[model samples]
Target chain A: MRIGLLKRHSAVFIVYVILAILILTTGLLSDVFLTFRNLENLLRQVAPLGFVSVGQTFAILTAGIDLSIGSVVSMTSVLTTGMIEGQQQLVLPVLVLVFGLAILIGFINGTIISKTGVHPLIVTLGMMSVVQGGILLYTKAPTGSVPISYDFVAWGNVWKIPFPILLFASVATIAIIFLRLTVFGRYVYATGGNEEVARLSGIKTGRVKTIVYMICSFTAALTGIMLASRMGMGDPLVGERYMLDSIIPVLIGGTRLTGGVGGVAGTIGGIFIFIILSNALNLLDVTAYWQWIVEGLVVIVSVSLYFRQKR
Target chain B: MQVAVSKRLQRSPQHIRSLFERFGIYIFLAILIVTASLVSPNFLKPQNLKDILNQSAALGMVAIGQTFVILIGGGGLDLSVASVMSTVAVIMAHNTEGQNSLFIPVMGVCLLFGIIVGFINGTLITKRKVQPFMATLGMMIIVQGIRFLYTKGMPKGEFPPIQRYLATGDIGSVPTSIISLAVMVIIALFVLRKTTFGRKVYAIGGNVNTARLCGYNIDFTIISVYMISGFMASIAGLYLAGWIGISDNWVGKGYELDSIAAVVMGGTTFEGGRGGVLGTIVGVLIVMMLYNIVLLLGMPVQMQFVVKGVVIILATSFYASFRRTQT
Candidate 1:
């Protein structure tokens, strides 16, 4: 009877099974696969994307998408590194200003989308171009570096655990609580589930949507800062993958891309699955080109499964 | 008879609105042209005009397909178009080995490949119940991966002269590409206006359940729309390869965005079932002109993105207000 109940909400369960199989296979195939050091490194590797996916969770929960999240991340990275300029004393102030700017961009995106009734995809795509172009115009190439002191956010650990993993866990925990416990979080799901019904029920659907998009962009900005700290330098092109990559895990985690039916728990499993898959491929020394094929197939199969499950 | 009478009775206000919507893009295009000529003497040069038209033809072709899909309106979009274009170009280059004789067979293969891709996309959306955006996006990724593997991350071969002639060759000073674009647009306009299929597309876009009750083959129509999109994308890919005389992985990198912006700017609401190829052509020209003006003003390329963003926002707001007033 308990197992039957578990099966009913077993999207996360299936993901765990797949993840375990992946880990087991990799552990058997490679000598270094199960090492604590390597596993820790993999967790750190997934952190930036993990953060962005959390943001996507909110946006998708609200029935809109932030295509500009990747661009915002890229721009944030550029601005952070540009402002920090390797000056240790400048990191804090510069980061504050960058975050402020990112939030402002998010606000503009939210306002335009909600007020004008423009499709979120188009609005965010336009914003993506603007941000990317602005970054390119500001620095034709990678131009500045963050201070070395900031490396702890990307690399350093407390009590043998990586800081990024710690950061991701806390953020995920907060997100879980916000989604499960808060009125506003429920409003987001309500808004996505049926905007008209939610509105008639006294929810400010527009505001909910705008705030969700803002949160999405804000997290993306945070990711950019982390990436900048990790690389020690900002490259204008680094965040391009986030546009698609961030959304993939959310979908794979059984969060409906159409919106309103899933949460962050599945996302964590999705992240682990992807990180482990990539790590296994790396261990197998698969060519990069073939890896693309594998990743694409995985997304297609998982999405097909999700659609079937929904039906 | 009652329906006809009501449509006739409602025609006056609708006529004025439709007239404005149809011709408004032309007015906007004319204004941009006048401004460009005034600001930059180079803009009026016959060669430059031809260059602009030639450049827009490829994008215009893709936008026509986008118009068809958007016209059907169940969140119909083919993000895979750009990826399809890139993969077709890579296949052509690899198969032809840059030999002029093999170009014809390779072109046939490209079209076949497009049909296969379109079939997959259409099937996924209709039969599998996948969202159009997600299905096409998945197709895009898959095609991109295929292209990468096929080219081994580095493509080789020069585009054939026969293909180049399609883009640059002229008949009585009119570029062949522009001429082909005009023919395609004419055929498209005729189909959308005069054919049963066109009516079905509009009917579906305007109201799916009603169309289904009225016995329209909704699934088939939707699939055909995607098929046309794939076909158009292949043609655009050929033009791009010929114009650039190279086969590269990112050949169609920005076409999906550019085509969407063009379709929207042409006054096709996201709600669908409105607008036509003429407006899309105007939209494409306007965007190309904007790029030209930015270049003439010696602005950096990055400014173009800002300009495009602002234009989209303003146009969308304008349409939103217009809809409000109408309501």
Candidate 2:
């Protein structure tokens, strides 16, 4: 059993080793790379990615991908600011409505996917278009401001640690526990491994699928809230990159694209790797265009690791 | 025997599904055109109608290329088409600088870029065991990065006057764009339906293991499909640039999704094999009509996107359900 556990965890262990090597090299590139200020900024950047990937972890563990999460985050960002409109009183109500809408979108995605047996990519791709269009129709340009009072979500520090890090840590901790110590989580694994077998065993696989989408989108909404707080305004395209970026961390952290294996524990290291690499590249005076090239290579390399690990 | 035949007729679910698969797009097209005409008189005008077809030719080319990739199955697609198109367009405009003489050289350069990008994507997927989605998406970012490096985030120059005229100029009442589209269609149709390579593609899409056991070169077939897709994207980039007549780095931003949507809507299953280019042309028309109607009605671009998304969901679900029944 101990050997089996080690075999299961070996992929994540490899990722952390990469992370350590990357940090050491990047830290040596410049004095500021290891500075407290730089690490705080890095944590803030990783926080939103962390939120989305946690939800992504749920979706992937069930052999599904939510392409619409980026749009969900985009909608949440705009709605959070547009409704709050620089006022404290509206924050609670606005968040309730935003999260409700996010859940509904997820529910719609889940229903079509489960009922029709259509590929999740196509369904969520459509949802992405619809939601993006809705945001544009609402306002083509970026609009809306956040109340300064809501800054705690993204900017506040607790016990000398940045609030974003704390929030991400808390969320990741809860998620890891839920997946590791829950019946529904086991059902997720079973469904991913073989839905026909799981269903034959009397598990409500459809419900599990729907709930995973909901959890995924709910976390996206949370990321949106954090982003809106950080940016101090709503931006329609802010979450545009999350669609692919979220998947990178999940894959890098050792989650299998084919599903039924891996967990969020690995994704934490993946997010850090992504943020640190990006941050380090910037610190090294790499141009944005070149950065994109490097980032592209990173996506392929990390994602391709899954296929190799299976072999 | 008579009783069995009659009983099968009574249980006509498969028959209904096949009918839906065969002519679903035609019905959808007719309805969309009728609705569009009713929405605005301008939609029916010869001039406006010509413009619609002319504009669709640009996107239609890209969609046809995507259909090839989609036909490869296992969720294979070229997400980098948009980036490829934009990069090619930028290269075309910048290199030509309004000179017709440079056209051949520019064409060669643009198509070559497409081939290289496609080769890289194919190699990643087949040789390195990378997922098609991620491989192409990564290639997309890499291409975009390269484009920005060349154009410096700002585009310069324009397509020569001859190219513009060729694009927008019509012969008598017919548009040149339509003629170009016909040539492309014939080429695509011939390659997909007539050639041995085409059959191999179908075999692979139907089942990779079976194809492999039969001694088909999986790597070569998949690589060539991507090559064809990339080559088409280059042609589309040039075609669209002639229409716009201006350089813009962001020209190809949304084509990937829109082209995939159009292809999927045209009765082509995403799982690959079993759909042809003719159906995809109709699907392109349906999407184009939607854009035209939205334009004629003064609807915002956002409305077009929403309608496209809703239609894709509706259309794909219809197909998906029928597919499930057959299985």
Candidate 3:
């Protein structure tokens, strides 16, 4: 019985082991890497991606991807920063507007995909471009700053835990519980596993898909707001990297491309594993060009192992 | 009435499908030309038409290769083709820098590299049974990384003079690139129409399980298709390098999406086994013309992406509806 449990949970086990190795190696290689300040910095750096990955887990578990997340992030950042722009009273309204926009984009993606039966890749690829363009055109590269009070809400630490990190943890916890204990979550997995079977079983497959997309976009918006607060500035190009980063953690978390399995806990581990590796490489003063190669190699190796294990 | 209806249905032979298919391509081309002309007066001008054709030439090459892969179906996607183009262009540029005699040798190297990358992609997808999306996505990342590393984030070197001429020179009011494109299209059309390998491609994409049962070399066809795609991608890269007169690490970025979009818009079903090079040429022209129209409207660069994205979805929806009615 114990061995069976171990076999089924091997993905998490592997992730933990990898994280441990990365942490230990980084500690040995650079004095700065193991310091409290550096650790705090790393936590903050990974916080936005952590939020995005939680949302991505929902979409990927439904056998769909959210390429619009990065653009959504950019849009939210620009919207929030532009609206508030040092006005403390407008912060709440800006957040609401950003979240609303996220939901709108998500619904659009879901509706178009489900109604048209077009592949998610094509749908989201189009959305990515559209959203990015929307943000750029609307903002017109205007420079703006977030209000200080909102920054406090976004960047303030409670007892040494950064607000963003705490937010990420709470979101992750909620996601894990939702997946493990909710019927909607089970439906999501079932739908991804076999769409026809799930539909025949009377699941509201369309609603489930639509909701997941909404959640993915919403989280992306939330992450963007947090990032805007952290940086105190809104830049159009800021969210460009999240599209790839979000997927890397989800893939590393052992989610099959065909979908239906994996959870946020494993994804958290995967996120840390990537963060630590990248952080360590930076600490070692690796060239930025070489760093890209190493990062790419790492993702390839992790995914290759995933396929090998599947076989 | 019943007898007449039955007779009409029966009289339409399988050959009718071919005729209908040919008609669809022509109709689509006509619609594209009319729409572009209606949208902008400058769209039909000879210079603009030549520009559209020149732009379409590179994308069309990549789309032709994409047609082969998609024809094989099985959720196959080649997202790394653009990255491969960038890498090949950089390699070719670096090797042939300021050397006239070395141009052909450098191009030979680029072609070989393209084949190797395509072979790896094929093996990973077929032999390893990786999902085509993930495999190609990973390869995309890897190649992009390698490109960045090779160029160290900055592009250096220049295209050979002869190579540059191939991209920029005009022959009797037609771009040299267009001539090259025409030759490639002819070769591709010949291969598709007259070769056994081409027949096998359609057969495999039409129904893989049946193709396997019939003892077709499924693996070989898949690999070769990817190899052909890679080779075409490299050639496109070389032309881009020559045309632009400079090579960058980011060259060909987002081109994979454009290529896939053109192929799908060309009436090639994502489900596979139902497209031709002729439709792809029309598709390429439509895409290039759309870009030119947007530029003519003086739209901002950012809005161009939005328009392009909307056009892709709209085109796919249009084709989807058209196909549904036919079936």
Candidate 4:
């Protein structure tokens, strides 16, 4: 029975194993790698990606991708900071406005994709273009500032553990429960597993797909807000990396691009794997160029290995 | 054959509907041209029209290849084309130094690199069971990284004499780039129209399992399709570098999504097997005109992207709904 359980979760085990090897190597190479201060910095730095990946997990779970996630983050960061402009009193209203825009973008993307039966990639890609253009029109350069008191989400610590980590944990925990315990979550799996079958089985696959995309943009917006607080300002391109990088963790987490498989448990590990690798690379004085190469190779190699192990 | 003819005759309603699929892009093009001319008097001038055609040559080449990849669709999109284009541009700009003698070897290396990238992409998807998006997206990142590392973050230089001649020089008062693109378009049209490989591409896209049962080599055809896409992207990069007269890593930056957008707007369904390169040329023209008109209007360059996105959504949704009605 134990062996059967192990066989089922072999992908998760492989991911964690890779993470262990990466951590060991990184710690051995950098004397400060395991230090509390550096680890905290790493967690804080990766908070944005952490939130983005959870949203992406939902989208990919439905066999759809959200290329607009990065741009949504970009627009939110820029808009939030642009509106906040160093005023503590304005933060609440601006954030509400920013998330509302995010929701609308998600709604349009989901509607076009589900109702029209168009590919999610194309819809999100179009949305990416629109948001990118809108951001550019709004500001060509980094603009606006946030009030100093608004840093608790990204910088402040509770019980010596950073607030970002706590926030990420809560968000990720919510995703895990939503996916594991809810009928809606099973509907996502069923939809992704086979949309035709899911439809015939009485699941509103279109609505499921739409809501998943909305969930994705919502988390991406959360990441954008945290990032704006962390940076105290917004750059139009600040969220650019989240687009592809968000998918990497999910892929490394053993989530198939084909969807209906994998979970958030593995994704959290995947996010750490990425953060630690980049952190180690920074400490080792390697040029940042190699990190992309390494990431690309890791994605291809890790996914292939998981596939083989499944067989 | 008589029964098939009768069935097709009975489906004349869809045939009339498919006219929209066939000529809808042209109608859209006419509207844009009219709007453009009304917005800017110079838009209808010969020089502006030629300029639009000239600009489209590079995207036209890449989009033709994108058409092939999208034609045989099982999530078979090549996200790596942009990086491939940029890598070629960087290489030519970094190495040429205006020396035409180095053209042969450099072109060979660029084309070879393109093939290697395509081979890696195809093998991963076909043999390793990796999804197409995952495999190609990884290649895109890797290629971009390799280019940047080789250039050490910045590449510098201009194209050789031949590329310059092609970029700005005219043959018989028509731009050489246009002629070059025209030649390729004719060849692509003929191949897609009359060749065995072309039929197989559509066949595979129509139904992979049925194609497999019919003894078609699914893996080989898919791989070849990617190779074609890579080759065309590299070719586009060369022309783009010359036309722009310099190289920046961002030169080929937006081509991947842009080419996909163009191909889709040309009435090619993502489900595949429905569009051809001939339609893609018209698609390329419409896209280029939008860019030119936006520039002519002195609008913020970003709105070009916004318009492109709007057009893509509208075209895809229209086609998608129409396709559903047909069935």
DockQ values of all predictions:
0.59, 0.71, 0.52, 0.73
Q: Candidate 2, after superposition: displacement of residue B326 in Å?
A: 2.8
In CAPRI terms, model 3 is classed as: medium
Q: Write the per-residue lDDT of candidate 4 for residues B1-327, one digit (tens) a residue.
A: 457555765877677565665677777788888999999998989998999998998999999889988999887888899899889988987888778999879988888888888888888988997777778888998898898898999788778989878877899989999998999888888777789999999998889999999999999999998898888888888888888887788777878888888888887777878888877787889888988988998998999889877877887787677667776
Per-residue alpha-carbon lDDT of candidate 3 for residues B1-327, written as tens digits (9 for 90 to 100): 457545655865543453444355556668868987887898889988888888888888888888888878887768888988899889977877757799998999998988887898888878877667667777777888788878877778888899888988998888999999999999998897789999888888889999999999999998898888888888988888788878788677778988887777777776678787878888788777767878977887677778878877776665565454445
Clashing residue pairs, backbone N/CA/C < 3 A, model 1: none
* Residue A127 in model 3: lDDT: 89
> 1 or 2: which has the higher DockQ?
2
Could you give candidate 1's fraction of true interface contacts?
0.48
Q: By TM-score, rank the candidates, best first.
A: 4, 2, 1, 3
- Candidate 2, residues B1-327, lDDT tens digits: the string is 457555765777576675666667778788888888887988889988888899889889999899899998877889999999999999988999989999888889999999899899999999888888889989998999999999988899879877887788888879988999989999989988899898988888889999999999999999999988898898888888888878999886788887887888886777788787887888788777877787788889789878877888888887767777776
> What lDDT score is found at residue A166 in candidate 3?
83
lDDT per residue as tens, model 3, A1-311: 99888778777777787788888878988999988899888888777889899899988888888888998988888888887888888888778888998999999988877666666777787889889888888876745787678776476899979777888888899999898899988998998899889999999888888999999999899888887887787878788889768988888887766778777878999899888888898899987767766776676667667667667
Chain A TM-scores for all candidates read 0.96, 0.96, 0.97, 0.98
Model 1 chain A poorest 10 in a row by lDDT? A7-16
After best superposition, candidate 4 residue B270: deviation in angstroms?
2.8
Worst 10 residues of 1 chain B by lDDT: B15-24
Model 2 scores a TM of: 0.95
Chain B vs. true chain B: TM-score for each candidate?
A: 0.93, 0.93, 0.91, 0.94
Query: For each of the candidates, what fraction of the native contacts does it recover?
Result: 0.48, 0.72, 0.45, 0.69
Instruction: Report the error of model 1 at residue B275, Å.
Output: 3.4
- Kindly report which residue pairs in candidate 2 clash with one another: none
